[model samples]
Target: MKNKSGSFIEWLIPFCFILCAGWLIWHLPAFTLDWVPPDQSQADNLRGLHHRNDVTPGMSGPFGGEADWVDYLALLGLPIFLYIGIRTVRRAPMEFESWRPADRVSVFIGRVTMMMIILLTSVMLYEVLLRYVFEAPTLWANELSLWLAGFVFLCAGLYAMQQRSHIRIFLLYDICPRWMQRLFDTISTVLIVLFAFFLVYGGYGEALDKLWRWETFGTAFDPPIPATLKPTVLIIVSLVAIQAVVNLISDWNAEPVIHTAADDIDQDELEKIRAAVGAEGVGDLDVTRGSIQGNQTERN
Candidate 1:
């Protein structure tokens, strides 16, 4: 086993990230950007929802409290996402031979560009038709579009990590031998955990302060600003923190071994990593060989 430095400090990073994220969520107010529909006809309709202290006495959206409930559930996705991200990053590096130079960039761009284009087109189409043709607009469509945008932004970060396409300097790592490279990887991971933990613990108070205010969209659109998204942000941050921990575990003991079972297995990739990193007798499978077999099968 490669000896990891600063054992206590290594564990501390993830803890800190969790604590800081909690503080941020609990103390911070929901983020709200100004939103005004282009058309004026239906814009007035939303005014009451925007900042109406004149809320009809005992009135709420359809399925009373249903919207809020949905918001709460949506918030849960953040943590779940972060958890997935950390797991993906910490998972064993692909066997070098298994990787293509374009793979990382391709995945990153494909997800972002496709989603952005589709959303932009849809939003523009809605606006043009609603304003010029129908002369009417709906609140649900606008809000739903914004929500989709938010989700797309969230997934982008996680996907970037997965591709290992994030910026890094190779001045030292480029020339380092295998063992030395491993040492640096271990150290960097430890710092990541430590920093993440500290951020969470220190920032939790700030998040909570905002939550207590019952902040809303502050616009006619009633976006559910503070009350909705703050909680979700906290959840997302915590999940990302957990992934960091899983990453440490996966990398600290991985090896370069190959698994030859025909059946695809969920953990098969991770197992291969552990063997290779551990420098055991097994090495990475020849993906080239697999590709050849696949081609042959297609011809047959």
Candidate 2:
């Protein structure tokens, strides 16, 4: 039953993404064009120059002015995609060091970050090809890549926190008593939460204003980077704080762990390499297979 459910979700997510992507592509002309002026034939709006308010009546339909079946489908697919992203990551092996509900959320965001990175790369490559090979560079590609890159950076930070891979000096932590370790964890979590709080509190007004005005980048493409990213920064930071608290709670009773220089090594990755190269080949390469074996034996 578990495998069957996983198979279903695996198929469903891609199908839903394709549906959404197709919907976006179908509306690409509308999205890229300047909003049609009130008296103008919608034909003249293709310069893609205007802001949100200048969108044509036809284009405005998706934003609640009028209803379309495809628009509804796209809207419904998004939350389903988000749900599946969370669910799928929960069932997968941990690529990082931790596991929790918050970790699941962060991993899902990491998956999204991966997709955005791919999209950004594709856009840049497309622009390069167009500019160098076809001599017809696009105005929108650069702005769109920038927009995707920003989200990728934000999402990566959240994922890094969940993985416990963010920078830390554990020299003192390794020597501390378990109680002291818990105390240190609590202090760090509190500090993170407080920083997120002050950031949101101090910037809420300006973020809200930018969003309300639907601010856009001043480029010819004029993507809504400022409007969306300002609020997103606050949101992602808040999520990071929540994830920190979750990490603290999850690790509250975990056994005390000793840290050392060897802790920096990724045993899983080394094992993968050892498997690929075989025991004899690994020995020939002097790949520290013996040390890894010793560590595993000691842990057991």
- Backbone clash tally for model 2? 3
lDDT of 2 by residue, 110-160 (tens): 766766677789999999999999999999999888887887889899988
What is the alpha-carbon RMSD of candidate 2 to the true structure? 8.0
lDDT of 1 at 260: 39
Candidate 2 to truth, TM: 0.75
State, as a TM-score between 0 and 1, how close model 1 is to the true structure.
Answer: 0.43
* Model 2 spans > 4 angstroms off: 1-69, 91-94, 276-300
| Global Cα lDDT for candidate 1 | 0.46
Task: Looking at model 2, report the run of 10 residues with the lowest lDDT sum.
Answer: 46-55
